[model samples]
Target chain A: MYRYDEHDQRMLDERVRQYRGQTERFLRGELSEAEFRALRLRNGLYVQRLAPMLRIAIPYGMLASRQLRQLAHIARHFDKGYAHFTTRQNVQFNWPRLEEVPDILAELASVQMHSIQTSGNCIRNTTADQFSGVAPDEVEDARPYCELIRQWSTFHPEFNYLPRKFKIAVCGSVADRAVVRVHDIGLVIVRDAGGATGFEVIVGGGLGRTPMIGTTIREFLPAPELLGYLEAILRVYNQFGRRDHLFKSRIKILVKALGADEFRARVEREWETTRRTVPPLTAAQIERARSYFTAPPYEDIDAAACAGALAAARATSRAFDRWLQRNVGAHRVPGYAIVTLSLKRTGIAPGDVTDRQLELVADLADAYSFGEVRVTHEQNLVLADVPQPRLFELWEAVRAAGLATPNIGMLTDIICCPGGDLCSLANAKSIPVAEAIQRRFDDLDYLHDLGDIDLNISGCMNACGHHHVAQIGILGVDKKGEEFYQISLGGNQGTDAALGTILGPSFAQEDMPEVIGRILDLYVAERHGDESFLETYRRIGIEPFRKAVYGASH
Target chain B: MALLIRHGDIVADDWVRLDAEFDTAAPLPPGKLLVPLCLWNARRAELVARDQPVGIWLASSEHPEAIVDALEDIALVAIDFPVFSDGRGYSYARVLRDTWGFAGELRAIGDVQRDQIFLMKRCGFDSFQIRADRDPTDALAGLEEFSLVYQSATVDPLPPLLQREVRRGA
Candidate 1:
């Protein structure tokens, strides 16, 4: 993890003081509600349906054990003893009072964290692949670049009030775990023929009311010119992006209205001028950032001996074998394995973690992995470098904590949002729907057989849950004051990202489980060989699934 | 009276802002006048020939190119923010300063509140016409909101990382 220096700490302290003054002014009626909304939102405080929700930024989803413990403390003292991890890899406390938010921010600042740009119309917290430095298929470590971007975008004077909120994602691995294609700006670390690492810059990709796959504006942007290029894009957007209507504001709509070619030309022209005014990133800075993310010290273990011990454990416990197959991932190191502690246990909200669970995860991080944890975009915590020999002991401890659900990519591991139950923007409640679906697919063997289904649910078209890019997407719609779910098929968030097509009329809340069952039954019947749900859906297309769900009369 | 902050001081403002379109039926006002961009476009020669110094005020939607060639005669460039959140003026200020090299007074007008002064300063605005109801003295404190900034702007053109390194070296 990148440790904050005194400069960073000072900035956070100053921000806290500023926010506290703003909050006091609002309380004293010196500031109007509309005036205070912008200030509070920039600090990631949202007035929800029930109470104010405070979103704390976990920059690029990296948390040290001490920071995790601090989060648990905040959850216990300031909030409702639980926190919801969002799809963007940030965490939200749902019941914080507006008056206490500045204090919460002050606490977070103590741990080298603050919620600047986590919301509001600005460059938001830039996200990256959670498996950045430790993944086996990585071309380069993305954390260094992510840290560089984090510093550059924080409190950026020029882009503080963009036309709409902007999201930037970076991916360094062969696998697109960060869902880079559906962000406002996506940077994929790529190598040129000369083996020089640069970026494939994709702009204007987002999932909202209008979902879009980002177009590659620049095929290859040198790493040194990243911030300059970013500034150019933001400058063009700030000057020309639509402000007449809120829905027509995002950079995606601007890119769509002008077409990608003209947008690229404008950006290139702007870059030609803007790049000269800004200083380029230095080699020493890059090296300094990279130094923070170098591999942690690992004990040398005999590979064959460790393998034999793991085989004996797996042979003894079928439960351990199932967990190893589902929750554990292959790490780059010889004796280490990546462990994902599932937050998607049944009966709870998909991403909610109790304060106790938070402290337990912190302890687990200290015990099993290094004193670090990574929050995945799929709403799970990963111990990226757990040794193979300690897997069984870690599993038992995690299972006792009810986090070992063993459903990493299965149907029950649904990516959902805190919907109308908490969000004022949502049209319907999403947690009940996610819970209903989780209960319906409780059978482990059945879930494994279904295999690798990205079931995502959103409360509305805002697509906070990334419902647009799931294999099975359920979006809650408001139909004549009634809550209805509109199901879609064939959406994916992988390298080849695609939007799901709507499947006829939405079903009632009670019929959701049956509808999902019908879709899965059709998939199982139609699957060929070892075809996963996505492959089978693509092979057969949405026509058969639509017919299976809505019947073929129309 | 509307308060005007110039170079971190609340000074007497002699520049009069003309919000309405130019009327051929009426004579122009005396002293320095800041006319709207459209009015500047319509009567460019007339304004240039006048004895009083004239500046141009741009709406949030207006770009800096309209006044790039007109910078020689202009002593002030005023960018408007119809609302505090409409941020096009920040970019316009950068372009006016960094690209076209406008060396005169750059002012931010309309909805210029205390909270926005530091950023406006960074974007090359040396003068701020604070919102009519707000106190200019309180707004002046906004210039010191933070002693450090993280990105390159007109105030400090070096990359922040390099700036940090330079500070450490110093």
Candidate 2:
């Protein structure tokens, strides 16, 4: 985790005080509602249906135990006893008094975190792969570059007010866990023939009303010129991106309008002029940032201990053995296993971590693993450096905390956004719909048998829930202020990213879970044993699912 | 007709006679120049060296880095506020004075609303070229936009960074 130095601490502290004054002025009726809205959003405070929602920045999803504890404390005091971890790897508090947000921000500053640029039409928090440093497939850890971007994008003068919000995701490994394909700018760090790591830049991919896979604008940009190239791209987008219609105000629209070839030419022209003029990134600076992410110390432990644990799991718990096989992954160092704490329990909200659960996770991280944790964009927590022998013990502890569900890749594991029940922008309440589906299919055996299905829900066309890329997508649409849910099938979020097709006309709120159950039942009946939900759905188009969902009588 | 020399456009004042024929190929007509905000760039240095008309207009996208070098050669630099809410050009004009060594006439053009003049002038923009359709007198009041700026900027060089660092002593 990147610890804040004096300068970082000073900046956060000053920003908190400034926001506090702004909040005070707004409360005193000194600032108009419209004027205060932009400022409040910049500070990550949203006026939701029930109360103000404050999103705290978990920069690149990396958190120290101390920071985790601070978040737990804040969740306990200021908000409802829970917080929702978002797809962008941020944590949102559903209930916080508008006046008290500043105090919460002040506390966050004390722990080197603030919510600047978390929710504004500005350069947002740059995301990266959760398995950044430890992934064996990695060419180089992308965190250093992500941090560099974080520093540069924060309070940037020229790019503060863009046509629309910008998202940049960087992936260092061959496999794109960060969903690099569907970002405003995706940088894949790759090593060229000479073994020098650089970036393969992809531009204009986004998912709003229009979903697109980003096109590669720069095949291989040298690492030293990353910032300069990025500047060129932003400069082009800032100057020419559409502003006439709010719906069309994204870099993708500009790129589409210009045609990828023309857009690429313009970006190249800008880069040619500005590349050498920008401030040079030195080796020392790169090394200094990299030092912050250096691997933690590991002791040589007996492999026999891990074997003994596995033997015990085999002897006693078949479910635990299955979970260990599915949820655990390889670590960079020997004697350690990377453990994923699944947030997707059967009937609970996905990515919603209660205050008590947060404290427990923090405690688990400190005890059974290295004092570090990561939040995946898929809405799960990761104990990155758990020792192999402690895996079962950690699983036991997590199970006791109600965090272990053994459904990491199953149908019950859903990704949902706060819909009309909370968010002003949402057309319908997605949380209850997700909850309904989960509760309907609470049987672990049934869920496991259904196999690797991604169920994503969004309350509106905004697609904040990433409904477009789920195997089973549920989008909430409003028909004359009454909530109706639309279902989409066969979407995916991997190397092969595809938008799902709508099943049929929208269903009523109560009918959603039943419809989803029918679709799942169809998949189970039609699927070849080894076929995943997406594979099975692709083999037989949306017609079968639609027919099953709507019924032949209709 | 007042012929404007944009930042990157060549000044052709000497070679081609505007009265007789306008040569699009050659640089912008030299002499006293009026430039649009859209054309300011590195090419300004060449125009400045030629001692053509000495006015530079800043585009809305133009940052402080664009005109930091040409401030000495040009007699006047005008900043365009493409949109009324766009405060970027204001910051650039301020940086021209404090950060870079720009000392000549500073003008505001484009969407120069009535409410922005005060802050524009406070930020060191002296001259106001209100849009052709807008009322200049009303727009001139825009110079008095903000009465107080809590944080210092390029116009007001000292931020809290240089201020006393709150020392606690006995």
Candidate 3:
């Protein structure tokens, strides 16, 4: 994890004091409600439908044991004893008193964490792959560049007040776990023929009411010019993006309105000046950031004993075998595996974890894995360096703590947001639909047979849950004051990201479980010889699914 | 009295903001007159015929490139915010100062507030017209708001990283 030095600490301390003063002014009635609203939002404080919600930035989903413990302490004291992890790899506390927020921020600052720029119309917390450094197929470790951007973007006067909120994601692996294609700016680490690595910068991609996949602005931007090119893109966006309406304010609209080629020309013109005028990202600085993410010490594994124990355990315990299949991924280092702690157990909100469970995960990280954990964009936790020898023991501990469920990327493991139940922006509640679907597919064997699938639900067109890019996307819409869900199919989040197509008129909230079931049933029957849902959908297109959902009326 | 913040202090504003109907057929405001971009374009020869202290005010929608060739003719270039969150003025100010090298006073006008004055100054604004509802004197605190910035702005083209490289070379 990137520890805060003196400079980082001083900036955070200043922000805490700044927020404290702003709160005092608001309470003293010196500031208007509307003025206070924008300021509070900049600090990640949202006045929800029922209570105040505060989002805490996990900084590319990396956390240490001490920081997790601090989060647990804050949740128990200030919030409703639990915190919900968001799809952006941040955590949200739903019930905090408006007056106590300054105190909460001060507490967070003590542990090198604050909510600055988490919710504001600024360069937000840049996210990267959860399995960043240890992924077997990764081209470069993206955390160094992410950390560099994090330092450069924080309190940047030129970009802090963009026309609208901006999101930047970086991907270092061939497989895009960070959903690079759906961000305001996405960078894919690539090595050219000469073996020198640079970034392929993609711009104007976002998932709002207008979902767009970004165009490659600079096909190969050298790593040294990262900040310069970013400033150019943001500078272009800040000036030209639509400001008359909030819904059409994202950079995607501007990119589309001007056409991608013209937008690229404008960015090139701006980059020529900014690249020289602004400070450069030196090789020394890049190497300094890389020092923070070096691999932890490991013990040599006894392959004979490990194989014998694994074979014995598999024969004796079907449950263990199922968990091994679903919850583990290959690690670059031999004899170790990346373990995913499932936050998507049925009857619970997709990513809500209790304070005790947080502390338990922290303790488990200290015990079995390294003393750090990574949060995934899919709202799960990762123990990146867990030794294979300690798998059974770690599973036993997490399962006893109610943090283990053998669903990682299965049908029942749904991605959802706290919708109308909590958020004021949501047209309908999303958790119930997610819960109903989870209950409908309770049989683990049936789910495993269904193969890999991504089901995402959003409360509204804001697309906070990323429904626009799921294999089966469900968007909640309000029709004549009634809550209804519109289904979309064939959306994907990999390198070939595409927006899902709508099926027809929406169904009532109660009919969502059956609707999802029908879509899955059609997929299961039509798939040829163990094809994934996405593969089958891509092979046959949306005709069959559309006909199944809307019926044979046509 | 209408006021403008200049060099971190509030002072009486003497410039007259002419409506689009700035009677080109009649005498212009006796003192410095600030007119919209279209009006300036329509009456540029006459406005500069006297060449008495004159300024131009641009809406956020208007381009700063209009003044690229006439930097010396205008004494002040004011950019409009329209609303606090609409940040187009910052970019316009940068283009005026950094690109065009417009050494005249760069003022931020319309809907400007205390919270934004710091960044407005960073973008090369030398003057501000705080909205009538807010106190202009309170905005003086915004000038010295932050001791450091992560990226270079119009105020200082060399951010800390560049400054570090300079020091190493020295």
Candidate 4:
């Protein structure tokens, strides 16, 4: 984890003071509601349908144990006793009083965290692969570059107010866990023929009302010129991106309107001039950032002994075996594993963690991992360096904490948003639908047999839950004041990104469980020899699923 | 009185911002007149021939590139923000200062308020035309809101990393 220096701490402290002053002005009726709205939003405070929601940034989803404990403290004192982990790898407290937000921010600043750029029409928290350093398929660790961008983008003078909120994601693995293709800017760390690390830059990818897979703007941008090129792209968007209609203000609309080639030409032209004027990203600065993310000390445990113990533990308990198969992932270092603490257990809102759970995860991170944890974009916490031999003990602890659920990529593990139940922007409630579906697929054996599925639900077109990129996407739409869900199939988030196609007319909220079951039943019957839902959908197309769900009459 | 924030203090605004319907066919305003970009384009020769200072103000939609070739004659360039949330002026300010190398006054006009002035200053705006209703004196504090910045801007071209390194060495 990147430790805050005196400069970083000072900036956070100043920001807290500034926000406190702003809140006071608003409360004193010196600032208009509209004016206060923009200021508060940039600080990541939103007036939700019920109460104010403060989204605290978990920079690139990396958190130290102390910071997690601080978050738990904030939740216990200022907010409702729980927090919702957002699909962007950030956390949100739904019930904070607007007057006490500055206090919350001050508390967060003490632990080197704040809610800067977590919301609003500005450059937002830059996300990256949660498994960046530990992934076996990584070409290079992306946290250093992500940290560099995080600093550059934070309180960025020229780009603090863009046409719309901007999201940048970086990925260094062969598998795109960060969903790089669906971001405003996606930087894939790659080594060229000469073995020098640079980035393959993708621009204009986003999931909203207008879902777009980002276009390749620059095939290879040298690592040193990352900030310069980013500035050039942002400057062009800031100047020319649409501001007429709120929905059409994203950089994707501008890229689509101008066409990719012309947009690239404009960015190249701007970069040609601004590259020299903007301060360069030096190698020494990158090296300094890399120093923060270097591997933790590892014990030289015999791989054979670790495997033998793990195998013995798995042989005894079927539940442990299932948990290991679903929730555990390969770590680059031998005798270590990446463990995802499932927050998608049924009867709870997906990604909602109580204060006690937060503390437990923090304690677990300190005990098993290197006193740090990572948040995945799918709203799960990861202990990235868990030793293999400690798997049974960790699983036992997590199970006791009610965090161990053997449904990592199953239908029950739905990615959801805090929708109309909390958010004012949502057209319908999303949590209830996610809960209903989770209950429908509670059988673990049936889910495992069904194979890997990415079930994502969003309340509206904002796609906060990333419903557009899921293998099974359920979108809640309001039709004449009634809540209805529209189903879509075949969306994916990997390198070959594709938007899901709508099946048919929307279903009533009560029919959601059955609708999803019918869709899955079609997949189970039509699947060929352990083919996943996505693979089968890609092979047979949406016609079979659509016909199966809506019936043969249509 | 309309206030202008220049060099971190409130001062009398000397420049006259011409209305959209200002009579361009009539005589030009006396003293320093800030003409709209359209009028500047239509009466470039006449505006340049005048002895007094002539500046141009552009709408958020307009680009600074329109006056790239006329930087020598222009003493001040103002970018409009129609709305504070409409942020085209921030980038335009940078283009006018850093790219075009405009040495004279760079002013942010229209919808400029206290909260946004610090960033406006960083983007190379030396003067601000604060929205008519707000107090300019209070907005001055915004400039000193942060003594340090993470990224380099027109105010300080040295990157924060390099600046911090130098400070550490010192």
Candidate 5:
């Protein structure tokens, strides 16, 4: 993890003081409610139904063990003993007083973290793949670039008050784990014919009321020119993106209205003038940033120990065997395995990690791994660089701590947002819906049999949960304050991106789990031996699932 | 009454602004003319040399390096704020005064706000065109919003750490 320098530390300290003053003024009634709303949101403070919620940024989902311990401390003292990890790789506390938010921020700043730009219509936290540096197929680390973008976008003058919120994701691997295609700006790190690594830039992709796959505006933009090209795109969007309707204010709508060719032409014209004129990225600057992300020191260990781990998996515990098969991945170095801590325990909330659990994760990271942990966009935790010999022992500790569950890609695994229960914008409560689905499918073997099905839910039209990209998506709508659920199928978040089709009209809350059960049943009947649920659905289409769900007589 | 310049407005100020209708080969005017930030391209370089100006009013949207080559010749470089909240002009003003060795009077025009006056002044902007509707007195208060800023600017080249140490010693 990158350590904060003196300058970085001072900036965060000053920001905390600034926010403290702002919060005091708001509480004193000197600032109007409307005025305070924007300011508080910029600091990631939200007035929820039960209490105020504070969201802390986990930039690019990277965390040092010390930072994790700080987060755990905050949860223990300030919040309700728990924090929910979000789809954007952020963590949110469901309860905090407005008066104490400054104290929370003060604690966060001590660890080089703050909640700036976590909310409001600003450039948000830039996200990337969880297995960024360690993945064997990765072209480059991609974290240093994410950090650079983070610094550039933080408190940016022209872009601070954009028409709507903007999201950017970078992917360095071939598998697209970051879901790059569904971001406002997606940069896929690629190597050119001459073997120089740069970016293939995609623009205007997002999911809200209107979901879109970003179009490639520039191919093979040299690494040095990345900032300049990004400036051009943001300049164009800020100048022309609509501000009249909040729902239609995203850059995607502007790209759609202008047509891709005209948008591309405008951006090109802007880039042609600015590319040479903007400040050139110096080699020294890149090196300074890259030094923070150099590979960790490793000792060459015996490959024979991995075979012992496999034997341990097969000997006693069927659960451990399943977990080792699904959640464990190969490391670039021998004798090490990347361990994904599954948050999807059946009948519990998807990404909610309690304060005690946070401390446990931190301790585990410090003891077993390289003192580093990563939060995934799928809302799970990762302990990278764990040695193979310690896998069984680590599994025992994690299971006892309630961190080990062998449902990494199973049906019980869900990606969800704090919908109507916490968000003022949501129309229905998403937690209960996620819980109901989990409870109905509590059988781990059944979920494993179903295999690799993505289930996502959003509380409202904003789609903050990324429900639009799930293989099985659930959207909550309100009819006169009565919660109703809507289901969509065949959506995907992989390289070949496709939006799901709506199955039919909305269903009552009680029917949701049954509808999902029928859909799973259809998949089980129609699928070939090795086909994943998405593949089965893609081949057979939504008609079979629709028939099983709504056809009746089943 | 304050006159607002739209996208296609023609101006008679000393600095001539070049737009889509601009002719590159035209002879030099008698005095300086304000030019749009985009006029620094190769096609307009010949015309720029012929009409060496007292200053140019650069748009905030313009790239800073566009006008860097003419820094030696230009006298008073005026940059537009475009909107009160827009901040690109602050960085441009900083680069012009500090990095490019521009010693001319730096003026800020259009959408200038009272809240932004202090930051603008710290970034090397000395002159301001207060918007007609807003009270200049109120706009001046913008320069006093914060008792101190942590980060260094063109006015205070020392970063926060050094400044804090100096203050402690004092």
Candidate 6:
């Protein structure tokens, strides 16, 4: 809900013009393919297998209704009437022509949106929890800090061409919903012992071929000094990060090579000077940013009326009861609840919303909640302010529109990436494998009985699907030019983040669904009263699951 | 011949670059020469005896802080971009210009092209050695690629929100 100011608007408009000029120059042969590739990638345009895929930045995953409409308009007019939400809380359109990308950017800018750093070796779109402001357990609203970072990193001169892409995640809550442990930099807002809120800055976390949990570099960085500390860290990485090999170039590699203690020392040395020269964020400036994210007006509701209506609805409709249990989350506001419009409907790709669905969601936001929508890293859409009284009606309408599957945080909810079907970097196709698993688990009752499970699949080790942090992680691999999958178990993404351990050899694509089924069956047989898959896996270890999937001893 | 672009115009250069084993080549007499970090660090006392203004050439892998003490004596500092994507030189230039207070000319050499002129200039590179194949004048337009910059640079060092202040005190 941060509206663009005059300066912000002008920058985006100028960026569109700049990109148009760059596109023209490239087309006219003033720029070679290799030279233009870096430039185009910086603008979030990737030359995929089919066509150019443009990843648009949904900064901190917040989108206004007007921006959503513009996205729908672009998809209808320029793309194939759909957009795929990414695991990084961004959106990707699959079929934009290379030449019309500037036009697409211009369209996005009209609604104060642009895909500036969605890709490339720069500080990418800073992501935060989707329920940033509305979550009851949150210590502070993270949107303002996210907005500040977005402004600072936009076209940053010093860090425009980093050694590798950098990702930063902000969390203001006790629960790690934003997957902070797997980002290059994770800032958890925390109050100091003296009660002044600052950030616990975690550095060097990443997921790819090598997944690393971030190391806490600073226990408590004063709130105003956040940007200064970040500059110092980037300065160190920009100078020391490996450039010899692409895979070894992430900040995580540098942190590992030099050791976290040495890396922190270097950053602190640089910060000693940077903190003095650069002005820390001022109270007035932070207040100005906070002003943009204040709560919307709400009418006081009668708790008795809401409870009576909810109980009545639950008694009458089992479907309503199921939907309420899975899709609704507690809101900070007394009479309100946060709703997730499931984009993981069966028979379709996870995290994908059609143009009509996008428009319909915008309409629903205007009707039930505020005219604001948030895209989650799980690839779901969030209606963050639906009133408790209106929950049942909204659920019915959304479910009828095919926007609801009642699978938020359920087993059927999957996080997947566009694999070998479209991605040039993928070693195997992931969509078919995801579809196979979703079809096998189509029984709603069975899925619910399975309890909270995080299922994620990545076409390759790029980890865009975030398979490394899932309870059941599937990574696509190539063997003798044949597509196969290697599964991992017991990974987690919450406060205690851990990478999954691989089970035995890779499985054939045809055998993947059965392999998953065997793993689930093993879990059910071994589980004790309400033990989640993660808990059971932790207790029983991977031996049982591995034996079940790959068969017993020789 | 390397065409040196200084102060936004193509200028004649007089600095001679000394390669490795120069000390063993002969009893070398130093003049307006740009020496590598190892040569300077190893033979500073003898090299500093030269009465002429000296310069240093920093490779992408070298840290600028290694010669912070000698930065005052150095008349020019040149940073190389091994590849356009290798951005170590930008941070090197920023460290020299913004943090270390190296006031002499900071030049970008090797693999730098017309399209990178804007970024090079923003990062405090006042002199450029454009790649041999491209026309330097055409690449000069890169310096004017955009009229506005969102974040401050060495050339434009005012924080966006604090521009009204008379001076930003350290």
Model 3 residue A505 lDDT score: 82
lDDT of 1 by residue, A1-554 (tens): 78877778888899999889999999999899999999999989999899998888888889999988998999999987999899998999999999898889889999998889999999999899998888999999988899889888888888999999999999998989899999999999998999888999999999989999999998888898998999999999999999889999999999999999999999998898778887777787777777788789999977789999999999999889989999999988898999999999989998899999999999999998889999988999999999999999999999999999999988989999899899999988899999999998899999987889999999999999899899999999999999999998889997999999888889899999999999999999999988999999888888898788878874
The DockQ ranking, best first, is: 4, 1, 3, 6, 5, 2
Residue A499 of model 6 has an lDDT of 96
Candidate 4 residue pairs that clash: none
What TM-score does chain B get in every candidate? 0.90, 0.62, 0.89, 0.92, 0.67, 0.86
Instruction: Choose 3 or 5, whichever is better by DockQ.
Output: 3
| Superior by TM-score: candidate 1 or candidate 2 | 1
Off by over 4 Å in 2: A28-30, A551-554, B1-74, B82-170
**TM-scores, chain A, per candidate:** 0.99, 0.96, 0.98, 0.99, 0.97, 0.99
- Name the regions of candidate 1 deviating beyond 4 angstroms: B159-170
Q: Which candidate is the best by lDDT?
A: 4
lDDT of 1 by residue, B35-153 (tens): 98878888889889999899999888778898889999999999999999999999999989988889999999999898998998988999999888888998898888887767788
Error of 1 at A159 (Å): 0.7
Interface RMSD of 6: 5.5
Model 6 steric clash pairs: none
CAPRI accuracy category, model 3 = acceptable
Among these predicted structures, which one has the highest DockQ? 4
Residue pairs with backbone overlap in model 1: none
- Interface RMSD for candidates 1 onward, in order: 3.4, 8.9, 4.3, 3.2, 8.1, 5.5
How good is the docking of model 1, by CAPRI class?
Answer: medium
- lDDT accuracy of residue A141 in candidate 4: 92
Least lDDT summed over 10 consecutive residues: which range in candidate 6 chain A?
A: A276-285
The per-candidate count of clashes, in order, stands at 0, 22, 0, 0, 10, 0
Task: Report how far residue B113 has shifted in candidate 6, in Å.
Answer: 2.7
Model 5 segments more than 4 A misplaced = A28-30, A552-554, B1-170
User: For residues A1-554, what per-residue lDDT tens digits would candidate 3 score against the true structure?
Assistant: 78776666877888898888889989999888988888898889999999999998888889999989999999899987899999997999999999999999999999998898889788889999999999998999999899888877887777767878999999999999999999999999998888888999988899979898998877888888888889889889998888778888898888889998999999989888788766677766776777788788888887568768877887888888888889988888878889999999999999899999999999999997778999988999999999888888888888897777898988777889899999999999999999999998899998889978999999998999899999999999999899999998889998889889887789898898888888999998999998999999999998888788878883
Chain A TM-score (model 3): 0.98
